[model samples]
Target chain A: MIQKIMFMNGYGVFVWFSFAITFVSCAIIYIKTLRTLKKYENEYAKELNKLSVSERKIVLKKSKVASQVFASYNKSF
Target chain B: MFDLINPSRVFSWIQKLINFINSIFFVVLMIALTFALIISPPDYLQSDSVRIMYVHVPSAWIALASFTAIAFFSVLSFIFKIKNLNLISKSIAPIGLLFTFLAIITGSLWGQPTWGTWWVWDARITSMVVLSFFYIILIVIHKLIEDEDKAYKAASIVAIIGSINIPIIKYSVDWWNTLHQPQSINLLKGTSSIHSSMLLPLMLMLLVLLLYCALIFLMKYKTEIIRIKKKNIKRL
Candidate 1:
């Protein structure tokens, strides 16, 4: 209705623009986070593949330690 | 379901889906905002000045919401040591500050016509100003600390402490005699001062604003996660 259309009036520009900025900024961030997570996974895989038999064992050991540390830390929470 | 725990697949898909949904939300919000603007009528009392509430209310809501989020995330980060939580709290800081800035500016603009002054240190105004200070302090603390773990700890403390102020700010007017009008957005006010006609658009605008905040907060949190991931990789 014509009556409803006039309700927002001149203020629509400010309201909409502000909302747009916030939305776009968030979307960009979200995409970037996923990309980084993918990158990390790829890097981890490559490093694992490149390790020698003995080195692989040592690396796994370190990972076990790291996980344990993380678990203990988590428990404190 | 066990296969779904594959970090890259799971997280990337979530990211993509969230981004897609957020984009859709943005478009829908745009349509709604434009529709409201074009369709809604100006107030008889304040005329175009009433339009200010649409902007002012949303920004205030975001400012308040952001602080509340930061406080909650700070608790998570401190107790759980979740890097994601810490990053989220840090990233949301700037967005919160931005909304607070908008709220103050729109408030001043609204005040000129309604209050006969551009600025007043009324209970609401003073509390909002203090809220802005808290946002700035959070940002400053985040920046000043060199060690990430220590910084997270310190900032978490600040965030938790600052949250105590939010209730005070909300109730400041109620607790003290003030020139600032009481909550206009209240539902139980008997629809006397604000007519039913005006309330509809006002509520719609608020929803749009809240959606906007959620969109921004999600985006900022994502960016922070990426930035931290990169930082960790670089260190390795």
Candidate 2:
């Protein structure tokens, strides 16, 4: 039974290999995107940390306002 | 009801949907793979090699579908000058290219066994190659143009113009003498050449692949949005 599944009437290698490559590619893309998100989040957070207390508060406020506008725009949709 | 939804809410909703799909995508994928590989009977003519169709067909469908989607978003971005729409088009391009590449690769693999040749310059194949080139050129242009607005405009224009290839790819086998077989599944005619047993697994695989594409597109788009916002914050 195991041999039958693996050999697949002698076409097993090609069939299995194709599916493997496709799935591996999908996984790679997913991981790369996640890494990119993490990288940017770190960069942004680090930059925010560099600011003085008052400056950081002001920057955060601006971002909050921008997000509010975005939220409203989304609601309008 | 639509007015009640905001961007944050929509974003959160997409995240939730993606998470939900992610949970089930693998289970469905395994089931589909098993059905395709073992449960489905071998083709009378092609034998076990016919299993490649499950992957090849769906990837080709997605390759075409993604370009159509990119063109639609490009139009929206151009008309409304929406940065988010442009970012979406940008984010989707690489994934579209990946599908196109997979289609070509898997097609070549299947062809070598069944058609006795690994590569063919048939209408369907050539048009798919052209589609991949269009994607590469768009990516290159986006990289070369440093100005985000200019890059977006240039990419959108290219996307819209290159979209003409999509219909050609769809109709190429019909219009020309080609080794590539015509489309097996036709929704309009309510006809499919595929057996019911094989079709079920193929459809399931297609669904899983499409959900996979959606998950990737959303993740990439979210990252792009955050990256852009960070850049603006740094400038501020």
In order of listing, the candidates' clash counts read 12, 3
lDDT of 1 by residue, B1-236 (tens): 42443233334444465566567776766655664455556777766667667667777878898899999989877886766667668868877887887788777777776678879888878888988898898888868988878888988998999899888877777898876776765545544356666666667766766665565555555445444443443233
Residue B78 Cα positional deviation in candidate 1, in Å, after optimal superposition: 2.5
Residue pairs in clash, model 2: A74-B7, A75-B5, A75-B6
Encode model 2's per-residue lDDT on B73-145: one tens digit a residue.
8988789777677877888899899999999999998999899999989999999999999899878988899
In model 2, the runs with Cα more than 4 Å from the true position are A58-77, B1-9, B234-236
Chain B TM, per prediction: 0.83, 0.93
Q: Which candidate is the best by DockQ?
A: 2
Q: A3-75, model 1: which lDDT tens digit per residue? A: 5333334544444454445445545654664475445444454555455767656554545322232243345
> For this target, which candidate reaches the highest TM-score against the unseen true structure?
2
- Candidate 1 structure, TM-score to reference: 0.69
